[model samples]
Target: MTTPTLYGYYRSSASWRVRIALAWKGIEYDLKPIDLVKLEQKTEEYRKLVPTQKVPAFVTKDGKILSQSQAIMEYLEEAYPERPMFPKGLYQKAEVREICQIIACDIHPIQNLGVLIRVAGSDLEKRAEWARTSITLGFKGLEGRLEACSEKYCVGNSITMADFFLASIVGNAKRWEVDMSEFPIITRINNTLSTLPEFQSADPFHQPDCPEELRKN
Candidate 1:
């Protein structure tokens, strides 16, 4: 089968999640890079492919378009079913979703690039503060929950959907100078996740669109 295509920005956290999921599933894909910083995502061509013009629009091998990182991931889980992204128990499944949401909904939205860009014009410092504060607040709760459920990964001994979101948001936190020292559990989990080949391959720094200076060392 021909590889699927992923339209994404190198540094977008939401896009990052999809990349990691695809890599974890061992799915080969072509990347259609969109430079979010340069507003290239607003171009009419990209908008036609994705009305919202957001990065991380996935084109399946059969010529189907899929959007949204979480939705795309769920689709992958159902379509591929190997290297599953969720655990097997009733509460385990919900806990995985819950942790993913805590980062995606609470931590990611306010710190979104669009929101940060809008905030940048008025007060750059506030934008940075907002990103930092959002992560810290989200991590504060997430740290406690992980302590209860995690052994290695967020929901169990293996990776899950939550690990994808957690790892991506941690990258965001670092980019915005969010203090991560307090969230030891989160940092520890990230340390483990960061070393995995799939995560390493899907890292923002390793993306095709990534600048040479930012490429993994």
Candidate 2:
């Protein structure tokens, strides 16, 4: 089968999630880097591909376009079941989905790039503060749950959907310079996951568009 094409920006957390998922699944894909900073997603050509003008849209090999990273991820898992992101057993899958949703549905949307850009002047700082507070709160809840269930990964000794989701969000936290000392479990998991070649290769710093200054910091 031919590899699907992924349209995304290197620095976008949403896009980053999809990238990590693809890497973890070992699925081959063509990455079409959309320059968000240059406003390429706003062009009429790209807008037609994604009417919502969002990053991380997946164009399947058969030519189906899918927006939203979470949906794309679910599709990937369902379509390619060889390496499952959600493990079997009754409660395990549910727990993984729960953790994934907490970050994907609850925290991320509020502080997404488009939302942050809309905040004005001092309000931008307030928006960022709110985002950081909410993210930390969510991480605390995740840490409690992970501490109860995690061995090496978020759910068990093996990596699951929850680990991917949490890692991606925590990576976003690092970008904002949000201190992770408060959430030791999350920090530890993030450190461990960072060592994985899949996660390391999927890191934003390794992307072509990563600003050298940001990487140096």
Candidate 3:
């Protein structure tokens, strides 16, 4: 089968989640960088490709198109189950999805680039503060949830989809300067996950589209 294609911005948290999942599953997909900072995703061509005009659009080998990071990651979990991203237990899987949704649906949207641009415009400080507040509020509940569910990872022991969401958002939290001290569980999990080769390969700073000054050597 031909490789899938992913269109994503380098710094997008949702895109990073998909990248981590793809890397963890050992899936070789073509990455077509959509530079959000350049307003590339707003182009008419891109709009036709993705009606929502969002990054992390995926085209499967069989010509199936997918959008939204959670949907795409779930697709990967089902299609390539060898290195499963979800737990076998139904309740554990639900908890995993709950954590992913808490980040994606509740926390991320308010602080995402699109929302930041609309809410704070060009004032970088305002944008940072808005993001920081949103993330801090979200992390409060998230930390409590992790305290209950986490062992070595976000769920029981093994790394799952929840870990991907956690790792991705922690990067964003740091970006907005949300003091991570209050979220010790999150900090520990993120630090642990950062050491994995899959997470390293999927890092925003390591992506081809990252700016030279920002790229990790």
Query: What are the lDDT figures for the candidates, one per model?
Result: 0.88, 0.82, 0.94
Encode model 1's per-residue lDDT on 1-217: one tens digit a residue.
5779999998999999999999999998889988988889898988898998787899988889988889889999998999999999999999999998888787888888778777776687888887788778888988998999998889889799999999999999898887788888899999999999988988899988999998975
Worst 10 residues of 3 by lDDT: 77-86
lDDT of 2 by residue, 65-133 (tens): 999988998998988887788879889988888888888887788777667767533476776776787
Show the lowest summed lDDT stretch of 10 residues, model 2. 208-217
Best by TM-score: 3
Residue 99 error, candidate 1, Å: 1.0
Candidate 1 matches the true fold with a TM-score of 0.94
Ranking of all predicted structures according to TM-score, beginning with the best and ending with the worst: 3, 1, 2
Estimated TM-score per prediction?
0.94, 0.89, 0.98
Cα deviation of 12, candidate 1, in Å: 0.6
1 against 3, candidate with superior TM-score: 3
RMSD (Å) per prediction: 1.4, 2.3, 0.8
What is candidate 2's CA lDDT for residue 173?
87
Q: Give lDDT: candidate 2, residue 29.
A: 90
Q: Cα miss at 125, model 2 (Å)?
A: 4.2
Q: How much lDDT does candidate 3 score?
A: 0.94
Q: What's the lDDT for residue 82 in model 3?
A: 85
CA deviation > 4 Å runs, candidate 1: none
